[model samples]
Target chain A: MSIKQEELEEIYAFAVQLGKDAGAILLERAQERFDGSKQAEQGHIEKVNAVDLVTQTDEDVEAFIKSKITKQYPSHKFIGEETYSRGVSRDYLIDDEPTWCIDPLDGTVNYMHLFPMFCVSIGFIVNGKPVIGVIHAPFLNQLFSSCSGKGAWLNESQKMPLTRNPTPPLPPNAPSGCVFSCEWGKDRRDQPDSNLHRKVESFFNMASEIGGREGKGGMVHGVRSLGSATLDLAYVAMGAFDIWWEGGCWEWDVAAGIAILKEAGGLITTANPPADPATAAIEEVKLGSRLYLAIRPAGPSANETGRQSQERTVREVWRRVRHLDYSRPGV
Target chain B: MSIKQEELEEIYAFAVQLGKDAGAILLERAQERFDGSKQAEQGHIEKVNAVDLVTQTDEDVEAFIKSKITKQYPSHKFIGEETYSRGVSRDYLIDDEPTWCIDPLDGTVNYMHLFPMFCVSIGFIVNGKPVIGVIHAPFLNQLFSSCSGKGAWLNESQKMPLTRNPTPPLPPNAPSGCVFSCEWGKDRRDQPDSNLHRKVESFFNMASEIGGREGKGGMVHGVRSLGSATLDLAYVAMGAFDIWWEGGCWEWDVAAGIAILKEAGGLITTANPPADPATAAIEEVKLGSRLYLAIRPAGPSANETGRQSQERTVREVWRRVRHLDYSRPGV
Candidate 1:
């Protein structure tokens, strides 16, 4: 079910080209002002809806990628945000056919704001498992890629090959620092759950704990919400954040990032308990079942400490949340 | 006490050169790692203490600036962070001699972490009032400058022109947005007052008002703490933020920013009272004692709306802040 080394190299090269192409187009279009009135007229107001934002740009890019993949390997399958939005689903059982998942823009909000943080993410799934991934942030001149069994890498730099070298890792029981990234999803005012209050309260509590009374027990360096999922994942890959937790983002928001983290010896899963009982049964034991805990490649013995640190921080954050009801089962 | 156009121009040019020069030096030296052992050996365990962080680099930069100013204009007086750290009083009374106030590194913690949100702030105090200010964020390639009688500018681009050509003034009743920037400061633990906690809580309440938030009220874009006071002020000048409320920062932290904001038709004052009491005694209400409220250029009609928005937001925030003692107050 694993991808061959030669195939990984090919996928990496293809993804790099695709990412650059999309990045170039975005940069060019960003320089000019679109007719604000036209945008307002074109149903852009519905963009805040969790399920309604599939812009023409998204479809065009997905179509472009599909065409390229079909021409090169007609038998391969494709999974994309636009296609998924249209109710496409695939059985991710171990298989020989390669499955390509793509998110044309990981930070759509940032792109809309012209904030320069969005990026192209591509992942290769083989035998129902992600085996390779590539993410490109062209404006920032950063490219990250990795393949299963091979160490991850940044741009073509080998100095700090995405793998951790043998070094004494910080103790797991040791206090940890964290940077949590969250987005203000569209439904701030009228939602059934009203997750906004809970999210904000959690952020405040965690920040206060780390910056404790005179910042004593506050072992955290700081918390940052850069408003980009791709950049947040990349930061985890770079050891800039100890943990990244989130809920409600779609699979497209995380598919490629999951691959990147895995190849870098990280983990990922659903933030909430799975609706499917089978998935939940297995998730209870494996760290990977929990939503995106990308512990940077620590020394072999340091993994325990990293895991403990992550658990402690999350627990402390949960305790300090004041206004929200966290007792509604598991999320 | 007002500076002439020509003098302002000369000061602006000098400031630009010095800022760029110091920025370049900082970038070069920042790559070298300091001996952690030495820092620990200095008995400077006040790791989170605001005052105990007087590194040699700060002194070196201050000395460099002082010497440069003294050599270029022997009559000008110099005020800097390092000198002020050595037991200087906060009084900045007016004097016949021109005065320069400088903060070598505005976001020292960020600098220590290799984060790119720090800057060099240089301001000119003329007769006890800020007349010219230049804030350079070399890493981000941003430069904000302004002179008395002239408008504020960003990276040579005229953002708020000194002389308004015929556009309607900003509406007085326009709702205002704010960006509250602050640090945890040195006292994370015990103190007579938890000013930071109160300030942050207040900001949250104002930004995210409770139920029935009306008339574009409680609809702040979001809060951003980029870890640099100079950058925060620059953003205010650029209209990126409607209000910037901060505490625990010193004169050096804000001197340059005050000049820039003034030039941009903004206001500044302590966040204690509704009006500057010192200025209340003055015949000219416009020339009241300064505290720190850098407002954007608003049309005559806009003043009422702006004031209303400010008061409502501030009061709402004060209502939510519980930990701090706000009994003693004066803006």
Candidate 2:
């Protein structure tokens, strides 16, 4: 199931084309938002428009993607968000099957508000590993795509870091005081140990300034809940955000982003304290882990100072916000 | 000194041209971010680069704007962010002398980090009221502008709301559950009753759930700190955000936005309880009041129901997250 770098690039280009087509459809539908039909479904609520965003467009776009993928790779299996939202269990394996994971519309809420943070994500997986990824943000007119070792880019010209291709590993030193991103997902069941409490505390920990929150505080510049996870990971890969720790988003949300991010030299680990990607089998990272700590992309040649600085930041953060385990053993 | 509608429109057009020229400068400088030379001066800190940011660009842009204004009006008094940052207190009269409020660069941190949320804000004033405003976000390529009675607009082609010219006043109803925007200003000093503490509590209150935060919890959807006060107001005027509560930003940070928001049919008041903007003296709402609650814009001829719905949402939010008074009276 090993994909040639050349094959992956071809697939990556195709995925990008598919993303562009899907993005065009999404953009047109977004403008009709003012038509107002608040049919909130699949946990997508527009308190203002009350639109029945049961997101028919979501399915239509996915269907379009699957049709295009099948035309090229008839044997590739497909996993779409709408299907998972329809109650499909999170039990798919990246095993032998060549798969195309799709999230027709990531950031549905932002799309509902026309807040300019939604995207079309497509990832190609084989032997249970992502080798090609494409994330197109139509409104922003920026597209991020990657093919394993071929390097990652924005619109295929602006190599990430916009400083150098393949960013060096984070400088190892004390955390450089980062701005973070987190979210309070739709799961609002409240209790002392509930997801709501954990997220609130994590957010507070990130924004709490020096001399606050005891040992659990962070010198993070701030925390933003932009109501979208894909953009969070994509932006972090771009080095705009320092980290994105989450426990509620699904596989489709991270699949493509994880692929693109890795290509750019970033690491993704569980959100809990021991999120040591260094020791974990990279492929063991699950779509259902439900927790991810995405650090900014670094370059392979990251110098000792850079590595130490980045490691210092990571260690400090892990000490403060520990996440509850949501991953199962041996997928 | 009352400005006629026609005169205000002309001024707005002139102000927009100034903003465009200024925006071109800001955008070009942003490209040279890797060319970092943090000059720690005048409370501006570029911790990592520590290059001499002694922002000659800020001065350069301000001088550019002032020269253009003097050429046009010849006698207009100008208040720029860099000048204000240089110790000119916010105590000037909104006197008969036509004045210009400028923020050559809003969201300086976002600018420093290349986060795509910064902008150039230009506001024209006469007789103590903002008559014309222009905000140009070069990266986003979206320009928001307006005159008192002519209505707000985006790129001057798509009107604010982009659908309804003037949005209907918020309907009278329980808090329709809003998406909020907030910021943690530079003053991080903490105390049980300090402004820092109040902001932290207010932020937590908005995001806390049903049984959370004692009686001080709101059902607001989420919050974002995009690092720019002017853009926050401009977006709310565009109907993308519901409320922006701040007690740390200055007049220049909000003057242009206030002019744009008012023109779009929105309300501006103190962040504390009983923020009655309909009766608040327009001039009394100073550039340094330091505590302003900007409501979403409403449509012309808003129905009673719409007005009450919007008011209800506002009152509900105020009840949950009340601000401590931070304003000085008798301006």
Candidate 3:
């Protein structure tokens, strides 16, 4: 059943507060390590060998969030990063009940390094669709929140895109003026056909000179790898990043981001185009696909609606990027 | 003649204020574009092809800074990004007189995209060595400054590394716990022997598993590309980034950063290792070399001094990275 606006607003407020509380905890723990304390010196060794400290923090944060959520909503389903990694079945991802998909510490590696790109993400899904989202980056002092009907916001004051007005339309020649973001994920094998190889090749193509590199050149304005999928998605929602595509991350990583991005008028789809891309509509992919392509919101244009602009950008990106394969663990 | 402590302090204070003022000017111009104003819409088209708007701002900022500096120090030689780009001899870079090296607006691409990584950087060089530096990133609300004898600082309050105490020693395995930063610069040719190709391969080698990829892997903890060399250098000073290696950028791009990095107890050398890696001293590279490798400050270790740890880390990285070629424009 569809929830009323009042209930949605309440849920949104709760999630935002939860995100802030969790982010504060993370910052407290991270501060000690960042200051090169004796404890941090010891943890540095653990980080290199086993990531023990990060794991401990991740588990603590996840448990903290889960306890609060369950206390408030005993019937809600839960999917969390630390718990899922402990061997939860993928089937829980498709449950029809109101589900809380949370990544307590999204950029564990960045946090471990004290790089300041980590965050706490909370996404509320109803009937397999994300309806509310909240992300808090304590170091950045940014809190992004959104609900199904209400618009997206940053810090509860500035709106998404930070434009104060409508978002500017996509560049006339898409990707030419765009600021694209992608990641060199954990999988770093160097085989000629490995996903890492494909990623490297794709990054090269996008950054190459236009009409150079034998039709592979995209000549996009710039490419960034921020090491946190959640932060990348959050920035995309703000219209600072025009496009983002990646593979091999889990559902919790992008769930909240997807909710915020949609509320900001952006579009999300599979990294790979459809079989009949010419005529088929570009539909959003299942949350478990482990592949994603997100483009910023499009303002009005002379020839087409905002949706058309987004779809055409996706098609153009697909033509330039190689097909990436990322299968779920059990699928 | 060497500058006294009193004179150096005066110069440092002046440079910091100048950086802040220039940063404010840049932020004002950038704010109009970031808000999707009617002016930004027209500038968007110019950005795609001619980059006229960015060039105009870059020139304006440079002129504004130069005018101020000349009025204050009538005899100080100035080497600015805009002026040097127009065709200045490399010989001026080695002048014995006190020189002000400035990039009024660094990370032009990031500024044009409203990406929040751009900044103003100013360096005071004397006797061919950078003695004082200041960098102001208005969007990030960060100001980094340093002098030869004095230590580096962030926002004039927190010391570099943000560590209340001494920096932690380097990891026993060097690259294992390091956060490495690099950029895919403007030269994006895909040829096998090109600098871009070598840079990409080195990035791959560093990111791969230790035993994988034909022993080319160094297994660095994480790799980031933040799109601005100055910010990368400043972060390195803060010990947030453990290592940064890059080539093909100009002296103005890194002059201020080099000063700050050194004052923070960090080390800088050529990205390419010395011919006899085991026996040679890893001396600092010349500013005009257009190549650099910077490592964060090291605290005391069990077996070696802080400098020794930095030296060994450099050698280890050089073993894993390939040589890059970046000649001057008219050399």
Candidate 4:
């Protein structure tokens, strides 16, 4: 479904407001924790599973966002990580109504460890497609927002205007160097057909190929794993980092980021076959596709060179990595 | 060989001023290159041999510092990275006089790459030992300083009292985690003994044990190769990371950081056999003794546990790494 420009603007502003509200709550909670862990409390939030974590802060933040959105726009649907985990249907495309997808706290692991890399992400999905996104990182003091057509922006200042050095109608080139973000997901004890190992090896091989043996031949400049998908995508939008790839993250992790990236002249696709946005709905994007690639705009003169370099590096990487049978249920 | 405290203070203040001044200059130069390759006219910085890196900036900064100090007190000695590299004998003996040791730019690689991790390091060595240190990272707006008796500090605030926590230090108990930093250096040719290859393999083995075996206990939290020694040393002081082992870096690369880390109750020794400060003179610290290990603070309660864990891990790492012959001059 095509979203009108005015509708996109409205959604973008709503997403930004929701994100800032959630971000403020997160900041307040983070400040309270600065005095250090206040006694080991055991509750649903603290003791979710044997090892996995879901702090009270996460629940409160997520619930607060849901309530705010519902109160402001009662007809709009909402899906959040915390709510979804508690038996909410994963089917995000149940209706054509605009649904808000949120990850109150992305980089939960970093938050659990007090690593200071977490952020609040809010995405507005219209008819099963994300068209407006906002990501706020209180600690880093950065707010990234994007509407489908109005273009992506950082802190409401710099508009990431698409430029082809000489002016466009020119095919976009691959980035000079790409930065991919990888994370060791929850289930370290469970190895599904060496999926984890293949992912790790693929990262090393791909990085080496792109960066060259010592950063020479590879089309990519370098790679950085900052432990947060939201921040990685934001960095890609800001031109601080060129590309970000990942697997095993939930929709909540990338929904907001995907929208922001798209608006910033960045491309997101399944690492296997390139993603066809026309066919794939936002919520239908699967993690077990086991591959995700985000590429930034290349210069006019070197666009083709950059694309060919990236394609060659990715293919080389795929050839070396053993295919995992993630086709299994619950992998 | 014992120097007067008044003289040391003068040197410390001098170094701090110089570092801040140089860092500001570096930041300005870096900002100028943000839009395009500002250095294209002069060719790549790396194209010049390592020794030639004592550029006009370095020389100018050093001269500015030296002139100020000499004008005030002609008896005081100055030992800067550029000056020492030219002809000054590598000697750290106190000899009853105060000496200022400075690295105008630490993490030159990061500076060249525009990574924003490099810094200016300055230390006042008395009687062959560092008594005062200051490290300034202009871009990050962080200044780390420490006087032997006054305790370490960040930006003249948040004093880092040299107290070891009784609990087991975070490193060893830190589930198989390590971060290593290495430079590609000047030698890029594919040789069996290539330092880059050895460093890379060491990092890989530590992070993911040899042969990709899981239960073998070689896996680490992750590895990071941030190209800055002074910043790496400061990180060790901050407890953000565990161990930072590196080779092929020189005295200028670590001198000031070593002082700061020691003041913060951390440890720095030759990566091989762990040099004892009691016997090793300041001048005895050689570039050839490039193998270095910077370990975070471990308290009495956690000392044994941390030592055992680190010892085992390092030994296991040693088994996988090829022993380098530092006996070869100027490795």
Candidate 5:
């Protein structure tokens, strides 16, 4: 299942092209809607409720990417957000087989609104791990790509973290100086103890003054939500955001992003606090875990390696956030 | 003194160039930080609190812009974030005389994080109204500009909204289908009645299901925070976001944005609901109101004009959000 780095780069280039082609489709569809020439889009937009949404562009781009990838790699398996939502077999989740995981439009809501945060994501996975990934945001004109053992990049030239140098070490007090990212997912039930309520409460705790909230505050420097988990992950990979703690997103959301993140020297772990908070070993989250924590690449600290800095950030955030449950269907 | 449209466009051009130059400075400073070569920035950063931040670049850009503007137009008064923060007289708040309001670095937090949401905002006001506006985001390569009687623009070629056409009508059901923007500002105390807590609660109510929580939910189509009010304002002007309800930001934060929004045919009102929900008249917020609601341009509906659509959207949001109080200095 181990592919040569050269072959992985080949797949990465294919994915980069596939992602841009798909993004072109997204941009066209969005432009039509924005131009008010998309009277049919109103009928094309089907809501899974008021919060969760899917558009015809989502389906078209997913189909377009699937067709192209299958044409190029006939033997490869494929898992796509639109297809998976239509009741695809769970056997394609991840396995020893080479699979292409795609979120044709990662930020569908943003795309629908012409908010400029939507993108097309493609990840090549083998042995249940992403080896090559590409995410193209047409509106922002940013394309992020990575291959195993090959450094991550933006728009084919600049190395990620956008610094053209090694990422700086995590700032002192770690998450206290961090620009934290977390999403308010589609589930907005307001029960006293619902995950939605807990998520909001967690944001409150993370943003509260250090001594103002009964020692429950993390007082992270800032909180941002761009309405797209994939972009959040990419920014974390680029070192724009120090950490991204997310729940209720799917494998398609993080599949390609995880590849770019790891290739850029970042780390992804379980969203929830580990059972053993003091455990030194980092446990990467499963592809379909539905909850994830991603920390940016950091240079080695005087007393800690980059891995140790990421681990510390993950655990400190674990202390401040309530455990969130996002179950996969039939899990 | 009434100024000609030609004069406003002239000021708009000047402001656009000034914003670009200011953005270049911001980009250089941010590049230095991200490049890990900004040893001086460490000493240059000064925090107003754990959340509020200022940098030497903020001060330097302010001084640079002040010098440039004063040299070009000696009679024009200027108010900038950094200079005003160090204590400027209130007479410049919004007088009969022409004044320039600048946030040399509007999203300082984003700039410090290299998050790409920060920008340089230059606003020209005459007799208490934003007449000429420009905002430049160097990282995103976006430059938004507007004149009093002229149209708003992005990067000077594509029109605001990027549709190359008039804006579409607001969707039926108003905020129910609206992409909403609101900021979690620096004030993060967790008192039961604190503005921060209430703001969070309002978000919960706005995002929940239509019938949930005894009718408090607005069931907004989406909630997004880019961590920059100016960008949020710019996007609203571009018709990317349907409505933005914000509190606790200053005149410097929104001055230029108001001009762009108005030129793009968007509406600005008090963030609070109207005293009478049944009233048909739309009220515009003052330069220093601290609470503001911005709605994107809309084409006419079956029975409602574009203005009516905006007023309806504003009132619908008002019904769901708690009233917020953010006082101006020594008011």
Candidate 6:
């Protein structure tokens, strides 16, 4: 039986509240140990061991969120950050049953360092497709939420499609005009010649009018590495960033973001676009396959010309940074 | 005669409030034009023209801050972002007298995009020395301030030196373990093998476990490019970021940050270490020479070993990405 639209809406509301609650607990824990105001006398022993407390906080928040959600939706399946970190395979769990994909704390590294760029990310998937998502950033006091067909919102007032009139594709002689976002995840397996090293090179190329290592210039204005995949995707959905290239994050990191991005009319594909578009399936998007490219949606009311401009911008980006792709070979 | 300590304190308070007031006006102007919420129907012509409004906010806030500060300290020299952007050399302005260096809006790109990483930065210099600095981030509702000899602060409550217990030096053969921050300024003079291209290559190398183009690996835990220099410095002073390497920004971008960094015990050296540190004068910091390296302060109560550890961390970082220096060739 197809789940009714109203039921998805109810689930969306429930997950949003659950995200906010989980965010609160993490926020309190972070604030208590956030800085070194009083540690002026402590030694390296204290510095080296700080991550332990932070690890516990992560586990606590995940446990709290899991208990609350499982209690409410007793039959629902749950995949959380800590659980996945403990060696669970996140790719094969989705099915016809309702699965709550959650990143109880999406930017753990940033949190341990006291940088305020983390959030609680939650997405509800039904029949292997994301139908709802909610992300709460307590430090910034911003909530981004969406349900399929209901539209996405930021802090309940600002709707998505942050820009309908994004700058048209760059003049061929000129550089692309868009803010880009990417990251260097914890899994830095290969060294000087690895795909990551190349990806980081591409990021620098995009930010510069200057050519990269091989002397090819990307010229895409600037770049941002905010250290949060979920927030990076959310910002693209809100149009703060024109595009976000992601890798290495699990299903929990991108699931909730996919729901919000879909509701906002954004598009996602493999990090490297296919030579033949017919082979790509939007429905078969792999949340943990380790390579993704996301582009901002055209404004909801954008004319056909505006939509074409948006696509042209994406095409230019793909051409310039396609060599940065590392996902396919490994897969 | 040397200015009295109490008088310096008063000036610090005055500048802090002025920074916040200017920040508030800019914040309000930004919110009014932040996104394309109701603007989805607008065309590229309109989107391209939006920068015109953003430019107005930048100049308007600068004028507002300059006018207010000039009225209060009519005899003091003043340098603002807009005036400097109009081709005034920021150097040679610091004679023996008092002069206010201000960036009415730092991170204009972020402001234009409605990203919350912008701020107002103001620093008071006396006898060619930064005596007082105040950086106010209105969106974050944070004020970081400092006067000579007095400690820096966040919101005037939490003291600076965000972490008294910094990570010890990298053990031999270990990666440079720290969170790093850098920026991509908009000056693209030469393409295909420019200094920036080399600099970006260095950044990628720092993030990798494998060595850089020159066979050096920084092995930093991660990197952040939040797009705001003033806030970047403030965060460094607050200990959130372990090191910040900046080039191409004006004096207005870093003077306030310099004062706070000094008060917090943080240190600033050129992006490239001087060939002879013995000949360098802390007094001749060259605020607008356009390259800087900021490191969090060692603890006030730490032993000699702690100080040595801090120095070692800096040494490792310097070895990793020091090719990013764009100042000397221009200096």
**Interface RMSDs of all predictions?**
7.4, 4.9, 2.7, 6.6, 2.5, 4.8
Tens digits of lDDT, candidate 2, B1-331: 6666777677877888888999999888766543323211134545333211335567788889988988988867888877765673546545666899888888766665556778999988887778789999897788999887778888888677643533444534323346577876555444567776777777767666655678555655546677688998987887777778888677788989999988877777667655653343333345557777777765434445544555555666676665664544345
Tens digits of per-residue lDDT for model 6, A22-102:
888877876665353433222222222222123676677889988988898898899887776566343456667889988
lDDT of 3 by residue, A136-199 (tens): 9897777899998888998897677765455667877777778889998877676778888888
For every candidate, C-alpha RMSD to the true structure in Å: 6.9, 4.4, 2.8, 6.5, 2.1, 4.7
TM-score of each: 0.71, 0.87, 0.93, 0.74, 0.96, 0.87
User: Residues B260-291, candidate 1, lDDT per residue (tens digit)?
Assistant: 87677665544443343323321211111332
Q: Write the per-residue lDDT of candidate 1 for residues A37-146, one digit (tens) a residue.
A: 22111334244332234455666667877788789768778877777766634322224568887787766544443344567777777765666777776655667777
Residue-level lDDT of model 5, residues A233-303, one tens digit each, is 99999988998988988888888999999999998988887677666467887888888989998777579
lDDT of each: 0.55, 0.69, 0.82, 0.58, 0.83, 0.70
**Residue-pair clashes, model 4:** 9
Query: Worst lDDT window (10 residues) for model 6 chain B?
Result: B44-53
**DockQ of candidate 6?**
0.41
Off by over 4 Å in 6: A34-54, A88-91, A163-175, A189-193, A210-216, A276-284, A300-307, A323-331, B35-54, B88-91, B164-175, B189-193, B210-215, B276-284, B300-307, B322-331
Model with the higher DockQ, candidate 2 or 5 = 5
Off by over 4 Å in 3: A38-53, A88-94, A164-166, A275-280, A329-331, B38-53, B88-94, B163-166, B329-331
Q: Write the per-residue lDDT of candidate 4 for residues B1-331, one digit (tens) a residue.
A: 6656676666567667767887888777765554454521134343233312334556666677677667876876777777776664544333435677778777554454444456888777666567778888886677888877666776777544222333134444333544333333333233456554555455544554323544333455444444566777776665444567776666566767777777776766555533332333223234336666676644443346644554444444444443433333423
DockQ of each: 0.15, 0.33, 0.52, 0.16, 0.58, 0.41
Q: B67, model 3: CA deviation in Å?
A: 2.8
Evaluate residue B176 in candidate 4 and report its C-alpha lDDT on the 0 to 100 scale.
Answer: 55
Q: How well is candidate 2 docked (DockQ)?
A: 0.33
Evaluated on chain B only, what are the TM-scores of all the candidate structures, in order?
0.76, 0.85, 0.93, 0.78, 0.95, 0.84
Which portions of model 1 miss their true places by more than 4 Å?
Answer: A34-43, A48-100, A106-194, A209-219, A256-290, A293-331, B1-3, B33-59, B88-97, B127-132, B141-193, B206-219, B239-243, B258-331
TM-score of 5: 0.96
Considering summed lDDT, which 10 consecutive residues are worst modelled in model 3 chain B? Answer: B43-52
Clash total of candidate 1? 27
lDDT of 5 by residue, B9-126 (tens): 7777788889989899999888776556762256444456756778888889999999999999999989898888887464337787889999998877777778889999999999
Total clashing residue pairs per candidate? Answer: 27, 47, 0, 9, 0, 1
Model 4, native contacts kept = 0.00
